[model samples]
Target chain A: MPTMFEKIWNRHRVLEREDGQTLLYVDRHLLHDGTAPAFEMLRARGAKLRAPDRAFATPDHYMPTDTRRVAEIANPELREMVASLTRNAAQEGFTLFGLDDARQGIVHVVGPEQGISQPGMLIVCGDSHTSTHGALGALAFGIGMTEVAHVLATQCLWQRKPRAMRITLEGRLGPGVTAKDMILHIIARIGTAGATGHVIEYAGPAVRALSMEARLTLCNMSIEAGARAGMVAPDETTFAYLQGRPYAPADWDRAVEGWRALRSDDDAVFDAEVTLDAAEIAPTVTWGTSPQEAIAVDGLVPDPAAEPDAARRAELTAMLDYMALHPGQALEGLAVDRVFIGSCTNGRLEDLRAAAAIAQGRRVADGLRAWVVPGSAPVKRAAEEEGLHRIFLDAGFEWREAGCSMCLGTNGEIGAPGERIAATSNRNFRGRQGPGVRTHLMSPAMAAAAAVTGRITDIRTL
Target chain B: MERFRPVRSIAVPFARDNIDTDQILPARFLHLPRDADHGACLFRDLRGAPDFPLDRPQWQGARIALGGRNFACGSSRENAVWAMHGHGFRAVIAPSFGDIFAQNGLKNGLLPVRLPEATVAAMIARAEAEPSAELTVDLQAQQVIDADGVAHPFEIDPFARRCLLEGIDELAFTLSHEEEIAAFERRIGRENS
Candidate 1:
């Protein structure tokens, strides 16, 4: 009766303390530019990486999307962060995807693309979006800098086993409703803390029907819902995606044999179970600062006065004020100042294709700033080969290089203060893109639709 | 890491839910060194505004914070914990927290206490109404004593509680078990082969 999570947890268990905290052996440790502090900790402790071969490093968070030259990063401090990762990787023996490398991208996108993340592996990174790797059926989660140091020193982490939750999506999703919309809908229904202290296993027909890229997008935002991790059991679709990737197991048949057994038992019990109708999901967008304040594209912004709880009413009022949104304001036709279509959450090749399809014959609204930054250099190259860049460029959307551009605005890629943005990345927190910047999170197609109309227009209507 | 001792100090109430790490320490300041004074960056953007809670004279130098549900929700940046600890907050009382942030807090000797929603709300109200109200949090006893002298019990992982109480360095402790870790690795290597 063990679920997929239990199976992976058991396999990784090295030892359990009397208080029930288990030391789980990590199979893969991904690092990014922000990991300089962890390396510094290792230096301070006079320690060396226990398993260098199991770790990989890349520079993304601080990378400039406009240039490949590290010196062109502008800020000396940010340049050092990117350079430190390269320096640390050379000092310690581990693979480093440097700025000019075609393989360099957001760590989440690069992991799946390179096949470093596999079914049943215990993968970890210092970034919260590490949950994105669970799309490959791995027990992946994010860690802090201290935990990153622990993993670097010992290749293990102490974790209290989180309870298992299964979220089942039934029926086929309606056209124009993507995985981004589905996850946003789920977070809105259950609230941000709905899955706290639990790892979510997505199952049922709709989950199985998603492409690997779509599944990655869905799992990428699991952290946004307060879930420790999110997973979809490996199946034919997963096998097909990883078949010829760089790091796929050499003994393909044997690996597939083991992966086929990675699902939960038919009668397995879960700590909690939730079901969502996929057909009911629509192209959704956040109306407030928090991700939980999402509604259907056709819906109006909610009025805070209608909320009964005093605290909740206050929160809604504050969020509305920060977003510059009015009570009961129509989400559609709300003018947007910027449109960003990239990030680990929605910067995959398929995501770019979705956006390109919407931008094929349409021109971006006059005076609107729109950009399509590919998730990785490989994604950029592939999109260029397919003429997707030409389509975006023809439609007046700036075609930029890879890296996490405008997602967290850490790379000097932020909208102006008080600019309302239609973003395909995760998180709509206050001042996330920039100080006083109002962000509306949505799917790539919806973001593209907004770019064309210069407002928050529903993709279906476009 | 310093040993987590009992803290009795005036509490600051944020009176908001889902206050994310970005608000605690903006992404722009993430590249700063760990030793930098992060206290100055705490709620940097939100501060200086009219009636910002952290800027209020009564809440200055508070060592404890009372917040609503899902406090420190987004991002896995441990710097958020550092910002709070650097700002003289020894303990935070909330109904829930982001998993990564809570773990980061324990490793840094900043105690994260989970109390009932209503109980926390009452404490927040009390702290806000009475600026001089002080709350005591005793890790060893696993209880929070409010200004009214009512002790509300809370639960934390036993292992985490012990580590915080003794100020144990987790990396050092893990490294001490090197032999067993190697043995376990060999066994897994054999099993996979």
Candidate 2:
């Protein structure tokens, strides 16, 4: 019985070496601003892109969220990174979504929004969040710069197959407990390294009921759990989402016929299995540096002394010290200095809708800064057309241009040192937002609620 | 890629779990050219701290590192490996590593040696107790010779081992099979259309 992963893996197999590494052909290669080094490597060895038609480029990592003009990027070095992608894309014959293009956005967000990511395809990017494409039933994972060069030269990569894990979510999620909460809850239960060396397939009733956008959010954080990739089998919901997008196949019906068969067999066996109760999951939030150190919004901070293992106890103490949180402190009612509601993880139209619903009548708390950066240019236009931007602007939130903003702060959109922020973006690592910045990760709705109250307010309470 | 050679040097122990790529090389310096010396940027944020291990003079110029579980756990930035290599680290001994980081390390000629958690913990203890204690990481032998003279074996993919040992360029090797790739592409084109 072949699982969905095995079927896709077999389809892309070019050849296998004696060392158990198989060379898999990449169907779609997504590139971003951070890939200048890869192009440099290709040039160093006098190599040309083997499959330019299969590649797409965009400026994301180094793009300034404040403006779209290349000249206004402030830093000459950062401006060159964005310009380099355009230059490389033109020099080679690949499609480029430049800063001025309406389709331009975060590479991960641009992929699915434009329908370049589809069912049963093998996709790759230089960013770890490339796993976000697996929501469409693709076998996608991140690669390093060297692998990026190898893929450019050969359109294939050598890979050791990872074991498959099936995480089945049973029951139904409660109100205000979104897909972001579901994933945060999952990572909290299984520590960051829990799914190391495994590709996870999310299944069961709760997964099937999620919308395409929600599924993308669920899979986006798969890297946080150390999974090679995360996937959900393509179904009617997936077909509907990809039906008429820009890059959907011309032979749509034929493509659907093939995509319909992309699923695990009835007797498919997984190397590991985990079951989560959807009803038990709450609107979750991270109180510490790691995503695993999360708890229910109404819960208290974990005390390191309760951890019997010395190593774990020390890690907890360090995390607490960095976060400036104390043992047994309540997560609710903690003051926030900033609130950010956007990223590839939760920057879709649906996410903005959820946030707008909460900010319709409420003003942001005084002395606090809040921003709503849409994920893509398309998402920004859609939100504006629906008057969601007005809701956020009226609520005292800055409506910014699309690109990765404040997620990793690479483009200089960072919090002041020691500022505590409620963020809908992934990763709460120390200095992720800036040196000495404290980030508490939560769902968009929860973050919106926190913004209006000037504290970490549970969405359900609002 | 530089050919990997066996290394024997004092091991610096930073026994923190989940030391992400951000800590190894912060995102700020990611735009620096590939040829730049990244050694100074290694642990750039944590370097000046009083108790930080790398700041200790005794472990200066250490070529081997002992780390806790899930070392280099986040981000796929190859710069992290470059930072480690630039800082004169030839090998890292850890219980586990981020999948992409391990791959990046092997491709860049920096060995990532996975040992048992307890074994790594013991090595960290020994390294901390005796700063002069040196360990040898023999890739060809597939063993990590601890300071106690105990030889602990490790596993690595044979293909990776051969490449690292011979300084093989993977792109060149893959390009040599141009005929097979073209044939496969033609077949896929027919099937899709």
The candidate maximizing DockQ is: 1
**A-chain TM-score in candidate 1?**
0.99
For candidate 1 chain A, the 10 contiguous residues with the lowest summed lDDT are: A96-105
What tens digits encode model 2's per-residue C-alpha lDDT throughout A1-462? Answer: 999999999999999889999999999999999999999999999999999999998888888798999999999999889889989998988999998899999888999999999999999999999999999999999999999999999999999999999999999999989999999999999889989999999999999999999999999999999999999999999999999999999999999999999999989999999999999999999999888888999999989889999988999999999999898899999999999999999999999999999999999999999999999999999999999999999999999999888999888889999999999998998898888899999999999999999999989988
lDDT of 1 by residue, A392-445 (tens): 999999999888989998888898999999999999999999999999999999
* Cα lDDT, model 2, residue A187: 94
lDDT for B147 in candidate 1 is 87
- Estimate the lDDT of model 1: 0.93
Candidate 1, residue A161: Cα displacement in angstroms equals 0.6
TM-score of chain A of each: 0.99, 0.99
lDDT of 1 by residue, B79-127 (tens): 9999999999989999999899999999998899999999999988998
- DockQ-based class of model 2: high
Error of 2 at A306 (Å): 1.2
